[model samples]
Target chain A: MKKILLALSLVMIGIAYHNNVKAQSEEELVQICTMVAGDAEYLKDFRIKLDAGDPPPVQRFPVVLKKDVKYRFSVCNSKDYEGKVILQLFDNNRQLATTYIVATGKDYPYIDWVCTKTGAYHLVYSFRDGKAGLAVGLLSMVGTM
Target chain B: MIKHRVILYQALIIVLLSQVLSSCSFCSRQDVDLSQELIVPDSVIQNSTPQVSKAITDQMMQNISSPVETAALIKGLKIPFNKNFLASTKQADWFNTNFEKAFALGLYGCDLGYLNMYEKTSFVVDYISVIKRLADDIQVGQFFDFSTLKRLATNNENLDSLILISQQSFNRIDTYLSETNRSMLSAVIVTGVWVEGAYLSSRVAQISNHPKIRETIGEQKVILNFLLALLKVYDNDPSMAKLITDFEPIKKLYDQVHITYELGEPEMIEENGVVTFKQTDKQVIEMDDELYNKLITNIQELRSNLLKL
Candidate 1:
């Protein structure tokens, strides 16, 4: 009976180890980014300089929006891990507009704002513990009533 | 002895049934003769550069003038496309038709069919090169130097040779359609039409705002329109009608994604001889996993049905 119990314990340990490895791999695939806009229709293009340790960033094209149109921006991880990302928005003079903390992999976390002003803005998105990378793309602005 | 005889009879019956079921060679003497007659000219044979045949050009013009006859010809031409798809159990008929039509329309090589002769020849290499080059050119970073329109007008011998090689390679793909594979073919045709149509349509939308890009966008529209029309026909098929109904929601999603490609979304402002307008990231996310999986399932079912046929 003792020998059988020992074998069962080993099997359980092996399963746990396998699951842990899988969870780690999943955690590595998470990606996060922040989008900022001066107006609802256009997202300002900002430069992203990845640290040497960061994974190669994937490029995205711009999403177009009309003036006064509500837009939402979110960050997502490709892996199974549920983590949090921070989004910081800045005006042309580098003044803070909004700061948001988004939970990744659930509830498409993004900013919903209508453009009252039309111009360029900068958005900075940072991830926790170097777990995710940032993606930048284009968006257009249109005049809306 | 009686039992042994019965067993032998059963075996014979099974063999006969298998033979009858397996035989799929439907090519008639006419088909063979037509294929044989499709001979390339010496110039075309020596150099892969497609030499436009005046005879074919005239014939094509005449056929185009007669809309009814042209439609009939297109319908008839679709037979080999269908047969090959059914036989090979590969939904490659749509691709083959595009290549064949392009070639027949003086876009590829000299038209052999104008002489009332069909050539059992292959232009796989040329077709592949043309497709690859076109795809590359349209890629985001100018991966290929020549655009689709430019490739159509390419007069270089080396490029022509490459195209010819590609066309030849395409011939190796068996396109014989069987009853079992029909469903599979239907699924593939649907998927191909959906993807290609969406791609070209979005590109058209992207260029719609630019006067300079209008011509390129128009050409893309033509291709997209053709793909959509083809999809409509397949959707009308009674046996595979369910697939089309199922695709309606996905098609709507595709349209939503394409809306992001609208041309007027960007404008140019000139200030002190410098022109700059607001540029935002435009990206369309792919269909969700559930939808994608459903589509894959439908395609697999179609494939399985075709295999049975």
Candidate 2:
């Protein structure tokens, strides 16, 4: 009972203190993403909460990517999170592209990849350097062209 | 793939052993060593609940892409909504075992996704009721919020909202199940959704000329292996054991599929606040027509078996 109460309290605080937490709980993400998904199609979505100093968790989703389809990977993070949360795209063997850039100092809301392959690919997600926050990653096909 | 196969082989050997032990009612046996490679990670989603559920669920949610997207692909393929293909709602009452309930919950989840995608608002109640019945049986009905979902479904404009809320409701159930140590049920729900989604695509691909559907079906080779590995962790349980054993033939068909990737340069582009990449990497699927037809037929059989119980 005490642990349950403590966990609830922590989540509440996590929401109140971190504007970076766009989603208070998974429920909030649903309501927000409903509006966010728009006319655009929905694909796979992942909700994650990160803590400081923890190696950004690598959650891998194995999906088939066909040649000629334009695939989009986007993130909806708490706006208060100052640091960029990065989403990387990797084919079975090689690292393809990431949602954020370091030297150019630009972080993208999403990564749009026109797949030339029709096999499985992995969409990996993480945050910068032990950054603490909650984010939802969305995969969609914006177009075929 | 060799390493994965080796891991699966070792895992299944333990599953066979566990099956033997359970058959002898070895629950009280002190000699039975319980240490096995658990797919559930030690920590997921900031460590709030039982680690077992989160680990398995994280692994699960990753592998099964939302069927809504598959519905979209079917739509993009210009395939019409064929209600005749969905598992019958009347059968929801037939499921007496937790195994059946979990699988039915999943079957209907895909049905709901398919319905929502086609904007077939009137038919939503059939699935929502069956899912509610299953969810209630599993003691997670509180998370479903039936009234709110009904309201969302009644309005045509809220179709998008309905899908989002449905996703949210399921996630809430995942959280609740993980916290309450009822994640085995969660595993079944995930599996049911995967099976239905796979079956739905196969059914549509049969008549549709979409190449994506064919490749997507072929890609299940890896996902199935991953799902079987996780399900085998609970092979000691009778229902889980049966599911694991029953799913082997599908895995055999998948074994014949050869998926290879030709590496290419990945390009990045940024325009008007949208950042996108063009993946030059291409995946080639090698499977003859005979194998593809056989695989689809097997998927249909599996789905049919699921609905029967």
Candidate 3:
């Protein structure tokens, strides 16, 4: 009985500690996201918490991009998580830009896109290795083209 | 019996150890419920329309342009700020319903943004007071930092902070409303902001006929689709249904404005570890004076009708 109770308490402590760390990382993500916004006019923000399936489907959000508007997409990921986020800007199925380059294995903190067409665009986020992660992203208007 | 009890205890220990390992600082891929990722909470569905998904609603809300940007663009045209363009705060007492209050709150917010942009600190007090009252009526008043805003509004040097804080307050309001399954109010508030901003831009374009202002006014055609879609999401509500009917004429007017985009090579420039993609593509707004005039007239007329509510 004593050993059983000890094991139960240990499990509870582990879960609580894990949750505490996650909450702290998410708070830090918001601050880093704001810092990434720099001098641009802050428009919209996405705070995403993802626990993916085996295949890890892309988490997508829609934004209406305007013509002649230069917009910035900035992302700050939680270092506590194993997953590194890949942020992509898509016009339907066609990829317009991305924060990570698969061939070069390079990553950027942000990507700036000068939208020439006024229409709906998708911001697709996914983890590098189909892992669970938490991230915050910002959409800011850089200036008019 | 003792042997069996020992085996049971050992099994329990194994289960506990596995849980602890799974809950370690680094998460593994044991959880795989994709259905959990896409759906809105059952609580949210209970309070509002059930058909629209949270993602669609989120997109709808994001599509609405921030009034701060509109005010800044108008200010950039170098036109003299017109106090007449703002909705009257005296009408605050007349609004009793949540629909009226939410819409009026948006109207006052846009006015506040314009005042903040032009650094008209004195005019901000009245708008802020009315907005606080309206927000309180809707039970979202706690989001606004009234005392801080009041202090900042009194000082011209704090205009930027005032604008940022004010925008943040509205954002908090939207977030609170959405989380509480009252996102319909959030949609209504943004609609109010869009109407007022379009009205301000239209009125200015009439006087100055600034090409930039005209182009901005023409750009409303794109935003209008998003606004209409958001309203349609809640059209089952009688008030929202009426608002959609009200916008039909303006929508018809905007339909005449045609925009075409020509493809060009995108230029990538890297500066100080930052990359910027500059679009060389050009967009042409093809609208004659007749249609532009009609659109402006209808927008002004609709805005006047909405303010009366």
Q: Which candidate leads the pack in lDDT?
A: 3
Runs of candidate 1 exceeding 4 Å displacement = A1-66, A80-83, A95-108, A129-145, B1-309
Each model's DockQ score: 0.01, 0.23, 0.33
Root-mean-square deviation of candidate 3: 7.0
Which candidate has the top score in TM-score? 3
Give all candidate RMSDs, comma-separated: 26.2, 13.5, 7.0
Backbone clashes, each candidate: 57, 6, 0
Clashing pairs in 2: A20-A78, A112-B276, A112-B277, A117-B282, A117-B283, A118-B283
TM-score of the second chain for every model: 0.25, 0.80, 0.82
- Leading candidate by DockQ: 3
Worst 10 residues of 2 chain B by lDDT: B41-50
- TM-score, model 1 to reference: 0.21
Query: Which of 2 and 3 is ahead in DockQ?
Result: 3
Model 2 accuracy (lDDT, Cα): 0.68
Alpha-carbon DockQ of candidate 1: 0.01
TM-scores for all candidates: the values are 0.21, 0.74, 0.80
lDDT of 3 by residue, B32-91 (tens): 333343343222212122344544675457456677778777877788999999888898
